[model samples]
Target: MTEINENALAKMREVVPESQIHYLTKAVSRDDKNKLGCEQKNGRNVSADGIFCGGYHPKSFHVAYWGHADLTARLLEADPEWNWEPLSVDDRGLPAFDQNGGLWMRLTVGGVTRLGYGDSQGKTGPNAIKEAIGDGLRNAAMRFGAGLELWSKSDLRSTQETDDAREWLVEAQAAADVPAIREIWQQARAAGADVDTLDKITILAQERMEGGA
Candidate 1:
């Protein structure tokens, strides 16, 4: 990755700040929030069967691409000379199909300004104009090379729990009975087995029925 410019870095902090993750306290009830620290909710905070650990926290979004407006204002402030232009638009207008457009930014560096481009597409309805605009802008900002580093942080998804969920799935599927499998399916979902894994079990059933095996 091209190193982010020091000036750009400074501007990024002012623009896209890190997400504030407030650590949980007893007042923050377990069912009330999406996230709670591992310390307090240690015993059965997620699954009753112990397959899900709500505290496992996989990838965290420190500075998620804020919607269209904030990003534009932020980038502009960072570089007063910076400019954005719409590069392309979908030929079939909105309501006919989703809006897809390309946007480019002109950012001035030390003494020079360079162009960066981004592409964005969004579903046909709602605040799509705004949505498409933001998508394109964030993509361009990525090339501007400042706040994009927020994505560099990685999280170690809890492997043991994931494996345990898989094991329960295999054993449940072994029963080859609809009711038994259904029970496991619900349990797995509550336990936080990912959708992909859960979908595989459904796929397995479909394959067996189609093959008549």
Candidate 2:
């Protein structure tokens, strides 16, 4: 196997820029017959226009996602020759689906390759294939840390917790020096700061040190 270049790997793992982030709305039926959950009036049903999935009805929630085009662009930006292919092809030389009706594929970037699987979620025909390809690409890209943060539960902190983390982040960023920033980071960690918060603290410390703050 070819070794992955450290610089290229780092670039591939860099947090995706906010501008490339997008939101998707998913709906869950409140009816008891729905497989997602039992019927309950936990809160009011709401609706919103989804970026790729179209409008959603009440009982729907929004989630952050990176679209297929964005993921592809990022891959190309990280590795000019990045590529992907299905694990197996059918008699007609087309991508083959597994018994579960899902597609398995491999994504290669910076000399690293990983496996990912995707399903159409009941969709069929050409659209199903497209959706599976897109989903599989996202899954494989995640192994390389592309858009990984959005998938992390650490990014799902409650509003109050997020507010507190941001407040700590402001303090860390405003520290007089690297030592002060380190001290703040320690405090935040002891206070049970999430992964995202700790990452920001570490990044700020590195910036300060690099600039001789």
TM-score of each: 0.48, 0.58
* Per-model lDDT: 0.49, 0.74
- Top candidate, metric lDDT: 2
lDDT of 2 by residue, 1-213 (tens): 687866667777889887887665444333313222212332222422122323334434457778889888888888898889999999999999998889999998889889998888978899899999999998888898878998884255356566988899999988999999999987875565555787789899999889988
TM for candidate 2 is 0.58
Instruction: Name the runs in model 2 displaced over 4 angstroms.
Output: 1-3, 27-59, 154-213
Instruction: Encode model 1's per-residue lDDT on 120-142: one tens digit a residue.
Output: 35344446555555555565565
**Lowest summed lDDT over 10 consecutive residues: which window, candidate 1?**
21-30
